[model samples]
Target: MKDIRKYDLAIIGGGAAGLTTATHVKRCKDLSVIVISKDAHISYSECGIPFKLAGKVHDFDSLIVKTPDFFDKMGIDIELETEALSIDILNRKIELENCDILFDKLVIATGGKQRIPQPLQKYIGMDGIFTIQTLADGMKIESALLSAKTMVIIGAGAIGVETAAGIAKRGIDTTLINRGPAILSRLIDPDMAEIVSEFLKSIGVNLITGNIPDSIEGKERVENVLISGERIPADIVIISTGILPDVELAENAGISTGELGGIIVNEHLQAFVDGNFSTDIFAGGDCCEITDFITNKGTLVQLAPAARHMATIMANNICGKDTVLKPLLGPSIYVAGDLLIGSVGLTSKRARSEDIDVITGYATGVTKASYFPGSSDIHIKLIFSDDRLTGAQIIGKSGVKERIDSLAFMIKKKATIEEMLSIETCYAPPVSTVVDPLMYAIKDAFRKIKART
Candidate 1:
């Protein structure tokens, strides 16, 4: 066989994690790097797609963080619209549809694909039906809105809620259908989700829970969604069910996958191949699973921050350095109209399901001083297992993200309820109250712990 095109590092996928790894490796060393992206456009923010669809972002192109030329300037090759066929581990080569390439090190960051239920698969490929996973997906939705007066979004996760808020803001009739008992069921508890549901209702958006899309009915495009026996009129339909890891390449290469269907990796982010850890192959991003900080369970966080952290650690080890990725707490925040929600670690519901003896405290206060201008109601819930802080959830228009970050740090440190009660918080009229809302939450949790003792 002839000599194949070679590189020091060949990265599959050009999403957040893959881009991070490529940039870090090139910046740290003189290694030749190339990134393969299945999408024609790479380096765009997937998280910002909903904002673009909602008109918060003026232009879709603005979401493109780094262009292909930018990466070329940084001494990295970006191959767009390329698909990886399979990996030949023994030969250290990857077979692409166009050509075969050899690499000293291989990084798999294939990201994720929007998971549509088998029942809903028949509705796809229609002009008015879409899934918001890429910039192209957003553009399609925007174009469809010209004739779409009503939309039915299935699945009330972050994407669904955000989309509903955005479409409703545009004076379009929007309805959010959630199969679970509450919106954001995976992120926040029902109590917190209740506030969100009410906010949605107050904004003139129809919020329906405990209902599933039975089917889509339309001629050439989506027209209505049938739930049970009710026929809900809709000009457009968005399926935001969830995402699943793109692990076909890894599995076809004879790589091991974890229980969660993501590529298995060690603490160093090295891929487990052939019954052992392989330094030459690494994986990260939504395509791999990590240990949950609180539950010690194999979980897929699928957050950009977590993926970036994993990429950094994987790159360091790939460059002849030693670095281990810590367990992920999956810190995340999302906006739904005026409400900002933040969550980290485990939820009280999840903790109890794990059979952990959890004590929770709930507190409500103003994000700013009571007398300050623009103060908003803030609700916090802190969970303690065996007197140690295990989880936190925050809901507010302002100061929610920052407070959740502090609580996440406490959980990472295994801080006790006593430590959390005394956490130092800055007080101000505009930014925070004299007593922070988190402090009140901790105090309540400590009181509950003491009472139990």
Candidate 2:
């Protein structure tokens, strides 16, 4: 039996990875589990931060999945208000802000930190400025929003779009600014991003694209926003730019970090550098690198699902199950008001950057039959190489993510366009057409390939 004094396991961070790690081990009903969470709330969804700020969650309490009391009932010790400041791998000791704990196994799911970017850093904590990375950040913004009027959001990722929608829905003057030519350019093509931008502008969102912010014109608190010599009046400026991995503690401990500033972990999610190894010391979540299943290269993908998947492997390995860690295909979905956006695999630009020859086919269609009452426009663009599905970009109001996920799976498995031609899907008059649009897009991509040949 593992000594009780030296706990069976230690899980840092209370996000999806850390929480699931403890819960999965708890099912074994043998080992003593201790979870050290720096945050006050446990199992709160970090992705739901923007929703919380928008009052979609109603209250801060509504965001938590479970409290310390809930953990008590499950026989898991949750150490809240406790910060794991540093890790002493050789000594197997975790130095907390106030105390020290020795552990038999350690899992560092410490998660990422909110960065406001180099150009946007000065305006941080300027009353109107905020980031939607953590629950604490969400709560802080929600409290500050009581006085904010005109809000300008920087960046055009999921967080930016979501926050823009929230502010627009709240009757505030909302403008979403992007440094690139289009929104979510990193994820999809400019044309696909145009679909989203159009929808945002149609729904009362001030869309600002292809411009860099000259300065955040604020005295002490945010008062005015400037971008490309244009001064827009603003009471708040939420810089939903992006996130940087929280590698400070890990770096200080001399753990290997990735090229994208995330900690470098192996297939087992073990952090290594300079022949140094920490037994049972694993890192996952946004704080770690994403091993692209296709290229076998470490990419920066901060998705909760990937983190949870990593946690599962880390848990089983800790339990002596010896599970293999699977790389991810980088599937993602977004909801901007009525529009549900989704995509998977590589974008066309990314594929070309890798020096892969590609053919693209696009189709603009409806989600349902023409007779349907509540149908929205469904646009699909597929990337094909050698008649195989290489990548895709999709934008629609409904059933967008489902098709993207399916297409992404096919791409990872190297499914041919002919394979997509044979796929049978559920169809209805009100919700779907007789022929799925994916089939049509694949058929179109095939025709283009034939013509080129």
Candidate 3:
């Protein structure tokens, strides 16, 4: 019989959430902390995979933030390539493959898993077909690309679009198959998505919209994708159909999960037990369903920043410091080719669907002075309910990511249109105009709101 190991805190999964929690908790108090990671490597940036594949980032090793040795120095025990087989929540024990671990407090940071369509599951691990969500997946895809000439990417989410751009940059003929009528439908409205679609096409990406991939047909490896009776030849296929929370382990332990398949946690990031919060167990990262600040409804915020923030709150609460996870505005940004796209809170399309009356203001301008040699076109769309800013989306080659972040903060603070318009933004001849685009955008929104009333 194996000996049962014990710890003050035991964390499952070692991505952003797990690592951040361990770091913060250890710093606050003396605690026996052990982090269980199923991955071959820990503390690597998952979002940097696309840029690394496209050669924008020179080395893959640079993506790793904390090595195993670093964690050791931080006084945290890490078990690499070790999986937690089961959880005995009532007994405060976890069953590993060969041993049992007991903990005073448990943190579930299992994150999410890539969702491959049922028809496409059989093609996984086969030649020419791949789903990327880890460093190893990126390495395998890069190795396979040496022999691939044409590629077909399913799903037009951020990863798929960014991957298409990377492949297109190498002059490979790439086709992006989007299940929805417009790409990034969840993040931006159709009009904003159209701008991105045009940008993708200009970079030589074949765009297919409103089509569902029916089957993957090949003798041994992926060779053709059949959609609506049309067979499209492909040398390689990458599926980025999004991810679902990795909640099986949590749910198996009697933890309550939401309708969206993510663990349901209270404002303190503790699991809901018998319709109440349990302080003994906590969950964060992509696994826990978070409250949308605007709607106050349970939603999954899967971005890295959201995970980090949740981790921080969980760490604080675990260390005898009362901290609560705040509602999220769901701000996100994506870079595709030379374009940077950003959005926060509700989209105009989403507001209308939710039956919320809203008006939008749109403005197009250059990132810098009109006479600046490298000045590029920028577009901003602001959605307002009455005189309060509800959401915003920005597309530009430069100066968009920070603006989206600013707008997200505004939404979080419930900033009115007047407040947004009066806030002074730094400007220079080469960097920005004396009058920021946001100022004009808010003014336009104000005018529209007046007309609507």
Candidate 4:
């Protein structure tokens, strides 16, 4: 007989969303909570993996924010290395490899898995080829880095580019390949990506864009990758193409998924099943599709911060609080060498793709007073639709993250150019300019709007 366990709330995932929901629920109510995770470690920062490899972070152990023991001490039952095979929606039971768990309410937060390009699918699990999705994967790459002399990273997304930069900084020859015409094509416009491309090159990373590898050649290990009929030698190959939501379990249980392949949930985070929203079943994180703040269309946001916010909303709803998840702006920031790149909402390219007519404004200034010792050049771009702030992109040695965050809020509130122009800003010689770069960017937009009208 299979061992059967029961709890008031059973969360199927221990990543950012699942664990956060578990802790929040426990704090709000005295309900018995259990978290099941397929991965051995949970509560670790996936974003820190590249930095750890680059020697910016001390070690992998430091990336872990909490352990299973900590959850146990908090009275939250956690099952590590336990894969949930399927869910019986009618019975409210989750079937696992070793046991069957019953729950009064359930939260699905399966997160995402690294997407392997079709050309390299067959070479998965082969020696010298890797994907960093978990602490275990990062540790393996760390070990392999000791012997790796040359590395080829496929996909020029944040992870791929950051890893390439980090590995190259370690003195390893690195090549970054992207199928798109520019790196971070989804995050920023080609113009902004050019800046990042140059920075990566300055740090010794070979950039290859607008091409796909024809084949990965090697018997026991990856020795070379053929791209554009050109063969490049490689001691290691890392795939950072993209991430797909893990929704097989939810689909198998007859839960509805959106066009983006993520579970369809309501604003309250309740999952839709058989064309009806289930009060007892909820979904969040990368596994669920959320609405875009500007378009109000379903989209998948795989960032950890978005996942945690969804988790909080889900927990609040479960605790009988009337909390709802607002639409997502999908703000993101990345570190490549000494540059901090950030973007929020839609880029000009994305807005055009969505058929949105937009006007853009650009400004270049210094992060601090020109005479300040460590002042660096900062570039800002603002995208506006009908004079309302829609998106922003910023690149510099510093001051990018906070500005992106502020712009995200403005976009969420539908701030207008006039409103942005009148906003107050703090100034300091060491930390900021007398007139912030964002102010200049706003002024630039205002000028464009005035000229057009």
On lDDT, the candidate that comes out on top is 4
User: Which tens-of-lDDT digit does each residue in 354-378 have in candidate 3?
Assistant: 7888888999988899988899989
**Candidate 1 on 78-126: residue-level lDDT in tens?**
9888998889999989898768889999999999999998999977898
Candidate that beats the other on TM-score, 2 or 4, i.e. the better one: 4
What is each predicted model's overall lDDT from 0 to 1? 0.89, 0.80, 0.91, 0.92
Error of 2 at 72 (Å): 2.0
Tell me the spans in candidate 2 whose CA falls farther than 4 Å from its real position.
1-5, 273-278
Ranking of candidates on TM-score, top first: 4, 3, 1, 2
**Largest TM-score belongs to which candidate?**
4
* Backbone clashes in model 3: 0
Cα lDDT tens digits for candidate 2, 130-175: 7776677777777777877778888888889988887788788888
Q: Model 3 scores what on Cα lDDT?
A: 0.91
Across residues 68-185, which tens digit of lDDT does each residue of candidate 4 receive? 7889988999888999999999998999998999999999999998888787899898899999889999999999999989999999999988888889999999999999899998
Residue 77's lDDT within candidate 1 is 87
Better of 1 and 4 by TM-score: 4
Residue 366 CA displacement from its true place in model 2, Å: 1.0
* Cα RMSD for candidates in order: 1.4, 2.7, 1.2, 1.1
Count of clashing pairs, candidate 1: 0
TM-score, one value per model: 0.97, 0.94, 0.98, 0.98
Off by over 4 Å in 3: none
